[model samples]
Target: MKLLIVNPNISTSVTELIEAEARRSASPGTALTLRTAPFGVAYIETRAEAAIGAYATLVELAEHHAGHDAAVIAAFGDPGLAAAREMLPIPVVGLTESALMSAAQLGGRIGIVAISRRIRAWYRETVDACGMHSRLASIRCLDEPLADIGSVQRDKGEQLVALCRAAVREDGADVLIIAGAPLAGLARQVAERIPVPIVDGVSCAVRQAELLAGLAPRRASEGSYAAPPTKACQGLPPALARLVGREGHDNENEEGNS
Candidate 1:
């Protein structure tokens, strides 16, 4: 199966981070493609950035391959996930929701550590939308800047482990999720230090994408996702456009094979 992973932020580094984690966890036969915003939308540290990033993601999805077997919106906030699902017939999986659900299956209760203060509401909305709010222990933010988390010497892994400990001890959480697509590589490091299972949204989303694509006997309606949007899209990277068109064609071939 083929999956398109969309990182809402414009940071190519963040995109690479998520793609690497997805590759590590993906089933051997599954094919994965990664895409990101062409313009720089830093931090996604606030509600305003999340809103704009959502629109940008939708535009990218429209211009590119909605026809993949499934799509993973690789953002903890899941910025435009709902809108993407509504716009395309294909299943859209949110990293945050997928991670939390995975955590739920591992334990009775789970806690989330968001990337920033402004995203607390987004975290709550993700839990509520996934019907896992009752299982959520708490949502905490580092209150640190995104730049700091990305720094080499910042030791985000250790800090996240400490936060997870607080969630488990003070908040009574049995499972923990180190949220955000940008922090995809930090889970293993944190899990090693923390007693409970630590979930990474990127890995969770990839596995969920694999499951959803496998469960569906057939792909989405060709008229809906197989065809690219007729409306003009601006500022889309050439490479992304090619990837979308290629995936759409591959979907047609898959249909023909069946």
Candidate 2:
């Protein structure tokens, strides 16, 4: 199976982090392709950025490789998830939704440890959309910048684990989710220290993507994602154009028709 994991941001570092986690989580025999938007707002720290990230995600999907069997949006906010699902025939899985679903299945109530306060609404909206709001205990913000989570020296790792424990004990959460791609590696570390299961969105997303793609027997339906736009896209990466089959003039024509 070929799965495309998309990080809807300009940061290649964030994309690499998600790709590494997906590779670790994906089942054997599965091919994981990681891609990121060539032009998008960085950090995605505010609500505006998250909203823009949604559109950026669609742009990424529109230009996705034609050979991929499935797509995973590697964002905790789950930006452009519904739109992408509607635009693509193959399975489109969102990290936040998949992680929350898995977390809910593990326990009666789940708590989400979000990356920033601005994304609390995104978390709430995800639960509401999934009809799991009743099962959601609380959404806690780490109150840290997104970039800080990726720093090895920031001590955010230890702080995140402590927050997870508090959510389980004080927030009455039976399950916890570390809800960000940058914080992907923290879940297993936190889970070891906490009593409740700690879910990582990246791992959960990859697993769900594998399961959904595996269940589908039709390989012909693969790679039917929205075609790339026709207009000239500045700074469009060469790798992206090669994967999607069109660049420059041809790309604009496809996008115009799509």
Candidate 3:
């Protein structure tokens, strides 16, 4: 089965990290295609950045989404997840949603360790949307500066271990989820030290993506996610029109010309 992992941020390094973790976690016979958005900031920390990343994600998907059995959004914020799912026929899974679902299935309260404080509210909203807010113990933030802001002082592995322990001891958390693509491999790094199951969003999302890819695609009924209305999109780029499936365009001609 073919799987596409989309990292919405512009950072190719983070995408590589996610690709490695995905390969390790994915089942046999799963072919993974990892792509980082060529536009947007290195990281999506705020709502504005998330919005930009989401647009970049859609652009990337439009360019390379064909033939993929399933797609995984690698950011913990899950930018453009619903829109992507609506646009694509196959399953499109988000890292944050997958990790929370996995944590909930593993039983008991869920603890989230995020890279920054700005993402806490967004994560909380996501947890609430999943109706797992009642199972949430707490969302803790690591007080480390971004690489662009300053030298990162705290070792990610150590911080993950300590924060996970604190979540268990102080917040009464039963399962811990390290929340972001940057924290991808830290789960395995501190897995032996942490008592409970430490869920990495990247790995969890890839596993779920593989599972969803193997299943029959969802049937979009007449009312539910119905076909988009046919109309000409004026005052837009030709590529954008083709990307969104706008009317009055010859796809074969466009592809052949390109």
Q: Clashing pairs in model 2?
A: 229-255, 230-251, 230-252, 230-253, 230-255, 231-252
Top TM-score model? 3
**Winner by lDDT:** 3
User: lDDT tens string, model 3, 1-258?
Assistant: 888889998877788788888989988889989899988988888888889999888777766767777889999989988877655656789988999999998869999998888888888887887788999999998775676411221345567678889999999999999888877777877788988888999989988888887775553536645434457677644554664567633442233223
> Lowest lDDT 10-mer window, candidate 2?
217-226
lDDT-wise, the better of 2 and 3 is: 3
Cα lDDT, model 2, residue 95: 82
TM-score of 3: 0.89
C-alpha RMSD of candidate 3: 3.9
* TM per prediction: 0.81, 0.81, 0.89
Q: How much does each candidate deviate from the true structure in C-alpha RMSD?
A: 4.9, 5.7, 3.9
Candidate 2's displacement at residue 252, Å, is: 16
What's the lDDT for candidate 3?
0.79
